[model samples]
Target: MNPRRQVTEHLLRTYKSALIGFAGVFVVGVVIADIVAARVADPAPGIWMYVAIAFRYWVGIIAVIFISNNLRQFVAVGVTRRDFMAGATAVGVLASVAFAVFVPLGHGIEYAIHGGSGFSAATGFREFAATLVSCLASFVAGSAACAGIYRFGAWGGLALVIPALLPAAAATIFLTTDSDGQIAADHLSFPLALVVCLVATAAVAVLSHWELKDVTIRRSALG
Candidate 1:
């Protein structure tokens, strides 16, 4: 099997069950929260609106685990470090795009199930774009952070914490979502914010690759 496909498929398979459970829990939890909110709060807020914030962090966690745990295993099995990075990048991109769509789609589904005027196509587009960039940034940042720790010890890794956070921080600050589900920037124009987010993601991705390419595999047990 191709290394890229092998990594992609392995990561996807590893998360398949967890992803389904998360979806199930998210759907059920949001519905219950909406019901409870509708009864208690006057003009209940959209449950999915706030709940969707977890999606980016979730992507980040996946990236962290991918770098921290799977890198050694894949390399031991004969995958080159460059190939592992390539495969992991492919997985990150797919996951970023998946949750980008899932976030907005889930929000729409939540609104449709309850009673509310749906968000506009423009609002949805903003949400989609913001989520895509944010998730991508999160993924790269997570990998970079973990790669630092993997390459260096605990104290050494601390030095990289702030730099690793830059991508996700830039995304969160620049392409943030508003209450109305639109992406908003406090000072920067929409185009500029998008550019900043993409640049940050790309930079961190490069940093992650640099840190990981020749990283020592700390453990030998595949278990």
Candidate 2:
């Protein structure tokens, strides 16, 4: 296997337990909620919609750990900084895609559990697309934030905070799902919002690479 592919697999293996736990917990919780809601009131918009929203935040934290914690460890193991960033980026995007697929699929399962035909093809597609881009934005933004803090001191990192968070913030503000599981954007067209989010995410991912590529790994107490 290629070095980058090996790094990607290694990172994924390290995160496998967390990833499974995340999805498993969400699944169990949503099922319980659906049953309770069916007994009391109709569950609006399905639990998966809310799960989709949480996915971005969850992946964002993962991205931070991928950089702040894993970067130095991977580099110490003879991996190039460039390869580490590439592998991490690939992992982030793949994780986002997985959540995107899961959200819509879970929505359908929620409908099945509720004994309701609440699932709509159009809504599912909208949810999938929105979640994918938003999570991507969140992941990349997190990477940028951590890269800034890792390469520069805390004070210097503060300077890049706003721009580093722009993609995730904008995605959260614009692409929103309603109570009925329908997605809508605040100001821009839905498609346009996705495009802008993708562009911003790409830019920030590049910036994170630039910041991390030649980063100086400071000595720690363990070493």
Candidate 3:
């Protein structure tokens, strides 16, 4: 097998249990939320929408923490930084895509149960693309923050997190509307938001590579 593929597989395997657990929880949570919303006399649009959005952000933050904590183990196992980064990036992108699909699917399921009481889960292909790009950008931003912490410790990590988070924040703001039903894309066009998301993803990847390329793995105290 290719070294990068091996690394990616290993990383995926390491997180398999957690990912599965998250999926199970998300599904159950959405179902419960829908049930509660159904009982309400005046349920708002997209009753389960917040649940879906929260999951994406949760996954993003968790992805970074997982990568940061595991980098040393990968290095100890003789995986080159470049290969590890490649594998990690692949995993992040794939995971983002999976969630992008799953979130809307979950919403659709909820919509069916609720008799389509809310705004369409994902109205069009443009919305779906935006969701995917937003999720990907968020993950990349998180990875960049993790890389910063691993490379430069806490204070340095704090300094780096701002730029790293901007892309994800921008994507989120532009792609989503407030609870009041004001569409963000109305202010900033969908195409422009998509462009920003892509740029942010690229920038974070570059930043992560720069941080990890010459990094020294610290020996764990417990080891």
- Candidate achieving higher lDDT, 1 or 2: 1
TM-scores of the models, in the order given: 0.93, 0.92, 0.87
In order, what is each prediction's RMSD in angstroms? 2.4, 2.3, 2.8
Task: Give lDDT for model 1.
Answer: 0.81
TM-score (C-alpha) between model 1 and the true structure: 0.93
For model 3, how does the per-residue alpha-carbon lDDT over 83-148 read when each residue is reduced to its tens digit? 877877787777777777776666566666666444363453444576688777788788888777
lDDT of 1 by residue, 1-223 (tens): 7888898889889987897699789878988998998898766668886778778888899888887788888988999989888888888888888878887887777667665435767777778888889899999999888888888867777798789989899988887785557665677887788889899888888888888888888873121
C-alpha lDDT of candidate 2 relative to the true structure: 0.81
What Cα-based lDDT does every candidate model obtain? Answer: 0.81, 0.81, 0.71
lDDT of 2 by residue, 1-223 (tens): 6778988999899998988997898888877776776677654435567655788788899898887788888879898888887788889889999988988888877776675436789978988998899889999899889878777767788788778998998888777776446665568888898898888988887888788778888553112
Single out the weakest 10-residue window by summed lDDT for candidate 3.
Answer: 177-186
Superposed model 1: Cα runs more than 4 Å off: 220-223
lDDT of 3 at 147: 76
